[model samples]
Target: MAYKSLLTLASSAEGVAAAVDAAARVALASDAHLDALALGVDRSQIGYSYVGSGAVILQIAMERAEEEARLNGKALKDALAAQGPDLRFSLDSAVAQLGALTDLVSSRARYADLVVLPKPYGKGSGPEAEAVIEAAMFEGQAPVLVVPERGFAAGAAPRRVVLAWNQSREALVAARRALPFLKAAEQVVITIVDPPAHGPERSDPGGMLCQLLVRHGVKAEVAVLARTLPRISDVLARQCQDLDADLLVMGAYGHSRFREAILGGATRNMLESAQVPLFLAH
Candidate 1:
């Protein structure tokens, strides 16, 4: 579980500085070589409303978008420097249509142990960013550390870690992948909310996970609580705050992704309102 290489996505779009900052800080903390990628999006796909305007206006709008995109790359580089020390890392940029850009990012991400992505990994972070996440996880077959837009502070390594456990394939994958962090953490908590009473977990919820961690030499505490709130993520957030957890490791989209997209499941809710760094794997 020791990460030797890390890839961070710095989109040449607006609102990506915080993710770069967090990635730089994380790169500085972990014993891993860092790859910083500056992704540029096609302006044509950005604003379709420009189609209704005259040719002159459309040309002007495209030029303006290109200029802003250029500025976005500069800002991302500045963000890496603003990490308070000269970061020793390699920087690269990719400029292509949305379809190609995702493939490009995924190709680069294949060499890295973890892909660092921006949180709210939905429409708000832009379509390109969303594509990057899906590509890295699903296509590249790598885990993603979803950083918040607010960014993590310097020295953001996990001291206290929280594992959102449920007896599902996705959850099991996340837990096993997160063993490194759990072993390094001073405190680890296996938090389960509203366990299903009719399954094998009817006897002991989260106990098997805690025991599995023990086999890996990681001592963890377990907490099984009711869904006091509407969303499971809300309950996990409260637990993270109480435990002062710096990192949260959990599975992403155990159910149908389309269902979660429409009905708003734990993965979507957590992505939208993440309070700390979330490590996710499919």
Candidate 2:
């Protein structure tokens, strides 16, 4: 399905430009309505985390944080204007406690066809960024697209795309969610990292998936790679560059909520180091 409504989460002040750029890029490509959300923490409610117990210190910190949030909102509007002219877009802001940002983003994302988030930075990233990522993936019940720190100017639309295919429920879900992009892409490579040892072996690893997409007017070719590298994610990342792929679509893997909040070997690795934009769903 095509993304008729796109929502982008700007977790921090520094991420506004990247978020706007990504949202606008997709909206322009698919003629979708774009909604950019800038999340702000109520400094008074969250001051204790930054400042000690003193009331006066907390008040000062809260004031500074609030002011910064205001400036961030203004900057986001300016960026949107500069980048998304002639595109249908809206700017919104939300203020909540640091602990509740995830729920807010997830709830808002429910009405959206796709949720775009800035990639988590190495440092200086608040909990809101991480929470938004987790909520969008697990709670939004929608496709989550993570734009790298470099920003999403990959192409007009994801012309060269790679779908990481495995015979798992998660993979199927991811593929279905990314159908619009696959159908629109000039080239689609269904890359299967490694085949399973057991189960009835199919003549082609990614053949069934290719056929499925072909039924929907997507011409996808299969590419199989042996698990010779130390990390499958690393190999996948390299393959993206090798193929000059602009987007990488894959399923997110996480176990039970009690065991691990977000735990997936390849998912984690790609989340941390993927240079290309990623379209993921759980």
* Root-mean-square deviation (CA) per prediction: 3.5, 3.1
For each candidate, give its TM-score against the true structure. 0.84, 0.87
- Residue-level lDDT of model 2, residues 93-196, one tens digit each, is 76666666668878988889998887765555665676777787777887888888777747657888889988888889999999988888898999988788
Scored against the true structure, residue 229 in model 1 reaches a CA lDDT of 90
Model 1 C-alpha lDDT per residue in residues 65-121, reported as the tens digit of each score: 456556666766776677665566677665666657768877988888878777746
Model 1: lDDT of residue 33: 71
Compared with the true structure, model 1 gives a TM-score of 0.84
lDDT of each: 0.75, 0.78
Top model number, lDDT: 2
Per-residue lDDT value at 44 in model 1: 59
- How many clashes in each structure? 0, 0
Least well predicted 10-residue stretch by lDDT in candidate 2? 254-263
